[model samples]
Target chain A: MNDLMIKASDVGKAFGDRQALDGVSIAVPRGTVLGLLGHNGAGKTTLVNVLTTMLPPDRGTAEVAGFDVVREAHQVRSRIGLTGQFAAVDEGLSGLDNLVLIARLLGASTREARARAAELLELFDLVDAAKRPSRTYSGGMRRRLDLAASLVGHPEVIFLDEPTTGLDPAARLGLWEVVERLVTDGTTVLLTTQYLDEADRLADSITVLAQGRVVATGTSAELKAQVGQRSVTVTLADRSDLPKAQEALERAGLHPVPAADTLTAPVTSSRELAVVVRALDEVGLEATELALGEPTLDDVYLTLAAHAA
Target chain B: MTTTLTAPRTRWRGTDVFTQVLVLTQRSLRTLVSDPRMIVFSVLQPLVMLTLFSQIFASIANTPGFPTGVSYIDFLMPAILVNTAIQSALQAGVGLVTDMKNGVLARFRSLPIRVGSVLVARSLSDLVRTAAQLVLMMLFAIVIFGFSPAGGVGGVLAALALSLAVGWGLGWVFLAIASWLRNAELMQTVGFLAMFPLMFASSAYVPVGALPGWLQAVANVNPLTYAVDAARALCLAHPVTGVVSALTISAALGLVGWVFAVRGFRRPL
Candidate 1:
């Protein structure tokens, strides 16, 4: 509890008849990134709101940076920064003005605020577009500015709610790099994203939410190992060789599923590749292509989603 | 590279509410002035009203019950100021709704600042905007129409101050509405519905005595009527009869509005 930057226990929230978050618990330690992955309406934003002190949970408690969210909300707020699902910058003001306004709100003097704003603009590579209204900024520039605005207070903990939801691939990668730099600087982060690749790359640990419940939680490799499988697929040179290839693989104690001209078999080890080769040779069958594949985070996500459904 | 995360966690000493309000008011004012077209249109509406009403109703000044020595422009100018104040006050609500919709207010909420500061800053900024517009409209009335109030510069200044106070008071009402509704389009529709009747059915267009009996009752009870009537008296150098009632009503409305606005704003978005 002392080392944890964010901790929530049995948190619950509801809106009328729909439960937005129910009995959800998560703990993120200091100086690490916790990736929260969920589908739309899967209670991602609701949990972010609760932990960031924007909304009080209907049941249970949450603590951020050692302050109880409900009882010591201002203390929690002072130590945390939040970049909401939207850019959340004042579109009518220039990027510089937006950062300056936040800095001043956080009790920085005008000179200090300007200095901090300039530093963040430089860090985020937004110095060139700093004088323009955020409304005129590209989506990526706007997001960078929003993130910079959140960084003005040098908060120990940050909550980024779907930070790259609408960004292009390059922009998403740029933001991921920024998060990596922040984590290196010892800032704890709770990032919510829909992209599994994003989670796999950035998260020290991932929590998958489904219908206001924690469906799964683990590291990327651990999750992939849970539902993911390694396999070998062989494409036949001739369409007529599919049946022979299937029979040859079955004789080697491998169950092959044939689709089109390819036979795919789940394998426990890489030695099964030689087994497949020798089996094909014994049947006098020639293969066009043979490839081994590793399970990806996508498989883990799909399997979890299917099970949750 | 400046590393911030390892920096010592400073104990939270509460930020001054006044400073927070001032900082946010500057932000609101910056957004207001950044768009020249919005400023132009804000004054344009009253300029159009001044042109249409002063010309069309110029004959009313010569009628039997009309004030003998005052031109229609002089009497109409003060009422137009009050009307502009009402419109500007409604804009305060619209501005809050826009912030709420665009997520800026959410950012403010997640910060450590006092919640009431947002409402206060909104009202203060809109009051400043209304002041600028009123000054420009007054200059237009004096220069373009060659209109001079009988009460002179001091009287006109007093009327301007009264209109600003009234506008600031009325702004709280709309701010409360904005906090409760949290929808820009709905705020506009409701604003129009409320403002249209309040502006026309009061003493803004004509004297209460000149109105029909039913509308006269409305004009009598309407707080805006007192505001308009007081402003008209100050501009026309009358005995200043309506000042007490106008100030009292504005204070009462402001008190009620502040309570509700703060309550609504403090609730979860």
Candidate 2:
């Protein structure tokens, strides 16, 4: 039982002349989630492929569950599960059969395989449609089955590549809940997603990959603190009150930036909320609307993306 | 329902490679059984071709240099059989390309099983399909066109076996090509482009001597010719030269194809 379930050092991969991954490295501790965030062609999937043993890196090294991905791929494979961006369950086989086949491949007896398949179907809420061909399943159900198929072997580490990319909101939440449960039970996970909110909610730490390189890595809060801003927006009833509101906030030691019929100011503490009200009231202006905004991961992402560009 | 939170196993007992390949092969076979329309269509296409060729080539028997007493249908049955096997083998490659495009190969690669088993299972499944299709083609030829093998039942079985060997061997070749291309449309185009040349230049349809000097040279070197010639000898109860030579070539070519296919499979998708 290694504490670091995954470790890669300066792994590089190229397809022909195009370098898909350039000196990327990642490590995930047991029972935690590491979200790899990147846009398309940013090498998120390529990195997952390398870690899952589906592809060998051209340079450097990677290990999963303490086994070298190249020399000891079989051992690494046995301990890891992977749910790719597309649902990889067999389209020709029924959901139940797909799960059972994977179980049998993992060395389960026929009886045990059946039991595991039944249990997984129930867990994924796919029992009702288990006997139907997976090609007939809706996108969400197929994704669920693909996830269930990977879990049949009870892998110690799971790679989920854009698991919720095409899923509807409800289905996305369902998958997130399932992943959360897995992590709570000591399963280490490396999740790659395009959705910042998904990583913000589910990941313990986030790694941003841009053009085949890691641009940033930290907890969501830490990332926001680095490049994100907190602000309070005040909307006045009269357009003429804008200049007054701006001067009031600036005179009160707060810098308020003005927009059309409204003003936005950076706030470092909650005390600024009271300061804003008192300053605006003293200036003989009554506000119509007020809002306090915390810096979101989206802002952090945009800032980092701009810097990288 | 309560979800189990069992701790992950440190290291489970690994299944042997044979069992893994068998399991995957069984899965492929199950898909074949479930798709009745594909099976029916696959068998029907060859039967229809057999009928068309037997009727269309009825005058080839009168061509003097054609076998003295053999009907054109009998001489042509072996060619059609070998052609059908080759065509069916191409389907295996098409399936592999489809699997790669849809990420099915990625899923299989992530498993604990030997990676080579995936290609082996696909080739095995195609071998079985090719054998079944050949048997049906033979039966239909026997009843409809009065086709008969002079070497009796054993020779027919041996001929059938050779057709399957060609199927198995070429199935690997197609698999290798498909894995390398990783595109179904591209693989299909390449397969057909490659297939027409191989089948037409072979001695499957006409005697090598009857072909022009240059085409005769090509047929002499083509492996499909040995296979069709072998089957023809078996059906006519002729000397076994073609049979022995065809089997030797098939084994050697099959070995080469498997090596290339496995190497292609091991490459990154």
Candidate 3:
């Protein structure tokens, strides 16, 4: 059984009478990525702050890496690294200097700090520009440096709160590789993102939050199952055969809806495709196009968000 | 058959607080080395004040009973050092505010580091920088004016000690201001305005007796007067009372400033 890296029990937070998080509970197993999908003001960052021990929750308990956020804040902080939604590295310091500074802060010797900084520089592919002022680095380079700086002490758990929101597709892919390597090395990741594809591609388990509460959560396939199986699309060649094809689909226990020249119907199984093809043959009709799949995580995300509203 | 220890160790010694604070102080010091402009301005401010103030009052020292037998240059050296240190300390809050606004301080807030060390490091860096400037002004005072302090080595040491204390004490005021006020402009404006009033209304340039009755009373009451007076006595070998009194007032300010800064830091703005 995988060990639980983070466990929150009815965690609650309020900022000046406005409830930012209300009894939001989440748990992540070690070495697994839990993508927290939420729109703005969904309390993702608030929860991250509470779990990271940066802010004390008004109610309930949160434990990260076996350390209680309130009672053992220092230990909790030591175990996790937070890359906030915005870049926080000092612009005056060079990229190399920023990474080394964090290492030194974690009690690394000067020699070890420099050596580790060089290693991270190579890992982020910023070795050549490491000596330049961080202010001059490109947005993508700064983001990479920010991540590398956070990893200086090799934190066991990482909170990447919208880590790739502002990066282009190429830069986003580069960060994804770094995050993948971290998870592969047994690092537990609590990722929050606005991008649905990011959650689908990297999340081992997903928690959808809306209006500061978790609406639905499960694996991508399980959440997709909540939206039911996808509809099989079929385009009939002969217009006159639509009525017959529709009737044949109904006889085969399928509900067909005519969409332009194509007829579509929800399918409970992939075998429905073969059944539909046979039905088309019975109606003297041929399908010009045919496809069947399950609903995507996107569908589940929208459905859960809509319901939460 | 060996067993693996999968979990991280839990025992923490907790005695490394001072060491961590020292390391953080060194980090700020390292940044200071890269920014020489700050050093130049910090040193240059006192130098200009010293020359301008002493020169403006050169003709008056020729009169009798100037409090000390020393020249106005020697009389003004100790005050200049204290004032410089105080200014440096007050401005130290600006750096803390900058760090907070820029997320530098927030970085430490996220780490498992000593929270007090974050503000302490900034103040320590400012103290060191101001000390260098104070020492440089001392050299200038002695060279340009051909003036010698009454107690050669010990007096200079005492003067510097009193100045450091004043600077460090005022630093607490800045730290408190920086903690309570989040905006850098507000911090700088409040510190700057407060520092100048304290500087001018005190006996930093001339003896309190030389001023009008009301001005004399106000200057006499200013704690900065104690700093300047104590430093002057120590530098002129007039008496150790000046040094003792200055240090007493500075120590009190330091204690009060610390209490307030911590209180402000703990409470929300």
Candidate 4:
């Protein structure tokens, strides 16, 4: 019931000459998800490693579930479960056996371990394939089994490192639903991912990392707002009318950028949708398609990437 | 799913380290059991070597100063037994490296279990496997090669115990190296590189006098030579100071290796 289940303060780690994490600090409150967004080698996994006590920070301190990760690693470890980018379950063992082994290691009795394994198999939709070796399982199935393994001990906080990185859309949604359920039941989560939409949908707040530093941290709406505003996109009836449309929009104090046949301009609000219509009408042009589009996480990501570069 | 109680909370209970090590040992033994072919092949290689070497070196017993009381196979059996045990110990390092490479060791580290359990469990299970291989080789020496020791079955059992002790000690040394290297091929290369000299310079195949001046010096101090000499003495029904020294060295090596192995586990991956 701690308010902040995970907190890192000025954490720094370096490998050889390269800094994998530099002054990276993040706080994840209880019963909330902190979505870590970053490009490859952006220290997302490195941060996860530090928080989970897999690696200690070179300069600063990190704590999970109120236990200092380096000094009280055992306590931190017992409270947090980590599912890496790749499934780390024992592939040679059956899914059931894998869960049972984890449960047993977590201090469950033999009978309790069997019961818990059976229960997790059903919950993860892996009951039918429970008896089959995980090596034979599909990618999605193996991923679920890995998640199930982590949950065998009912960890208070879960660190999912790109949990849905390679899953099909359906599998990703299924996994997301499982995560949503866990959060609803009050489990803290720190999820690192390459998918912006996954963060937008699942995260209570997002922290964007670039070059091992926190470039931005906010709610999805806040991040999107920081990048820009809701925009109006216009598609003209004639393809050659693109320049005229762009000029008309620009003349009305709108910044227009042409992408293929469409011209889009950022607007402070949906009220500018009328300005777009009026400008086009004043130029004696008709629009085939005109719509106001809200700024998405993708725009925020692109803007961050541009700023970092 | 509804019937299941997903508390979504950590109980924070602690399991004893002894139970954790025992559970992990069970896992290692289970994996070893599942791969019967590996065990069979491991034992088979020593059987082949024993047979080939006994036949090839039978003529060496006719040399002027060779031990007169026993067939060449009797002397060679103790050497092969030690060799087999050393070979089996290599598996400990290889298994640890494989575990590290596959992230299984990482998974274990993430848990609340004791850090040393992984190495201790591997060494324990390997000791059992090496013991089985030693016994199988001893039976082959007795039945197929017409080999008989003056010390009888008790002496044979004593030799088996000594070989296993030596192998267990060496296995920890390799496991320590594996934790640092985290590469199976590299571990095997280093282990064999070190093992060859130890085996070749030891009193396994011949007396220390049969070696050259420098090698005789090396063979005199080689730990494997003491182990083989002790086992050979036991088999000849005249257990000597060599037996006491061998057991003491094995115990000491096991302790030192264990400390290094645990320290290796404590180091970051």
Each candidate structure's TM-score, on Cα atoms with residue i matched to residue i, is 0.87, 0.87, 0.81, 0.86
CAPRI tier for the interface of model 3 = incorrect
TM-score of chain A of 4: 0.79
Worst 10 residues of 2 chain A by lDDT: A297-306
- How displaced is residue A85 in candidate 1, in Å? 2.0
Which regions in candidate 2 have their CA more than 4 angstroms from the true location?
A230-298, A305-309, B9-13
After superposition, which runs of candidate 3 have C-alpha atoms over 4 Å from their true positions? Answer: A133-136, A221-309, B1-15, B62-65, B145-147, B263-269
How is the predicted docking of candidate 2 categorized under the CAPRI scheme?
A: acceptable
B1-269 per-residue lDDT for model 3 (tens digits): 12111122232222256767787777677677767788788778778887787789887677665764677887878888888888788678888777777666666767888766766777777888888777877777778866587867788778888899888888887788888887789987888888888787888877777777888889988888888888877887875676677677777777887777776654422
> Tens-digit lDDT track for model 2 on B137-240?
88888888898868778877887888888778778788878777878788778888988898889887777778888998899888888899988888778887
Clashing pairs in 3: B230-B242
Worst 10 residues of 4 chain B by lDDT: B3-12
Clashes of 3: 1
C-alpha DockQ of every model: 0.38, 0.43, 0.17, 0.34
Question: How does model 3 score by TM-score?
Answer: 0.81
- Per-residue lDDT tens digits for candidate 1, residues A30-121, read 99999998888999999999998888899989999999999999888888889987888999999999999988888888887898888888
Superior by DockQ: candidate 1 or candidate 4:
1
- Judge candidate 4 against the unseen true structure and give its global Cα lDDT, from 0 to 1: 0.84
RMSD of 3: 8.7
RMSD of 1: 5.9
